[model samples]
Target: MKPAINPNKIVVFTGAGISVSSGLEAFRDSDLRSVGQHEQLASPHAWNRRRKEVIEYYNWRRECAGKAQPTPAHLAIARLEQKYEVVVITQNVDDLHERAGSRDVIHLHGELRKVRCCGQHALVSDIGISPQYLGDTCPDGHELRPHVVWFGEQIMHYSETGRHFKTAAKVLVIGTSLQVDPAAKLPKKGRYRAEKLIVNPHFDVADRPYSYRIIHKEADSIVPDIVAAWLEGQRWDYGLGRA
Candidate 1:
């Protein structure tokens, strides 16, 4: 389905699947580790009981996310800014979208390239996803922790994101199955007149209060086509559901 383009207001909400083609794996999708490993490695329990292991896991994640590159989907979204006022709100912690030249991106899950002091929890530095040893200290002499949000941790940047969602005229969703919060909530409640399009490889496609569902397709394959067509002044005829 082709979506009409409105350069004035567009919000691109992205998820882990957008970066899968780039060689990074979203924790939920990969079979590289057992469920227990993920559970033990990503939670506060791990941080308290297995501090060393926790640090190692996040450091490994940083290395892997760092090696990954932006995919066509990311580039396509970045290019959209040339003709449209675009805001990219992503669930993935990787900086691939920014690396691909997208100017305005909101990392709801936090970023892998930064660290914070464990003392005051103040943002300490942008360490580019490098390994953070257990003894690493910030300027305030506090141990530095991965900036990326962990399971059981609170997500950042909700109010800032909500304002944009309420003001958007077009919302393009990619590669998510409405399993997560706030991210899932954005598409359902937005401006009274916004086009919401969801692109996912696996999802139960059904009509809802605010969006059209496009299923069984990867973002890398479909996003460029949609954005390109939009740039060329063409749109799909979905009739009244064109929000």
Candidate 2:
């Protein structure tokens, strides 16, 4: 039999930057402004006023995600499962982490590879990057919408994600600027004594409470090395110098 997985938990919080290397554009870097005035295409207001535009925009995104493969950073995060119980909490809607072999992942912003009933959010179905049209409906015939947390919509699994951060022994925050709220507050929720690290090209603590070692580097350039060190029983503070 193989060795049992370690019970110690490692919570990985990711954002758009992690998937950028996979040929997917980060939200801030994408040409969403051209879709509508001020990104209205990604909001609930747009969904109500211009449903067709919303569907088409998301369909394009889903197609982009489908064509993109998981990056090295994604695979490195998945490899963490070999030594520890890993739980990924991501702001990205793409399924790259899952495609990279991560068994447990929570998408705070919702998922592009799934759809939910307009009448009942609980009724979710996997569509595997297939395009969602205006006429598609759930079993109850309620019009289906892309299962993403639109602008101003409440995030998914808030309480559960907080619990994971609060109890984790190690927290790895990668590729996120942590500029968004609710999810941005999660790293602060980690245990004060937990070993916390942030790997991003641009990130700021700006009064957050937990002790964090910040690595100012691109995720694809640095994350695999970090994973190798951790798996070899080395801490982030050992030989990794801060930039």
* Per-prediction TM-score: 0.88, 0.90
Task: Give the TM-score comparing model 1 with the true structure, all chains together.
Answer: 0.88
Count of backbone collisions in candidate 2: 0
Query: Residue 137 in model 1: shift from native, Å?
Result: 1.1
- List per-prediction Cα lDDT, in the order shown: 0.76, 0.83
Q: Across residues 108-194, which tens digit of lDDT does each residue of candidate 1 receive?
A: 988878888888658558987667888898877888877767788878888888777777777788877777775677677565456
> Residue-wise lDDT of candidate 2 within 5-53, one digit each (tens)?
2238899999988877788864337665544533678788898989998
In candidate 1, residue 32 scores what lDDT?
Answer: 55
Model 1 root-mean-square deviation: 4.4
Q: How accurate is candidate 1 locally (lDDT)?
A: 0.76
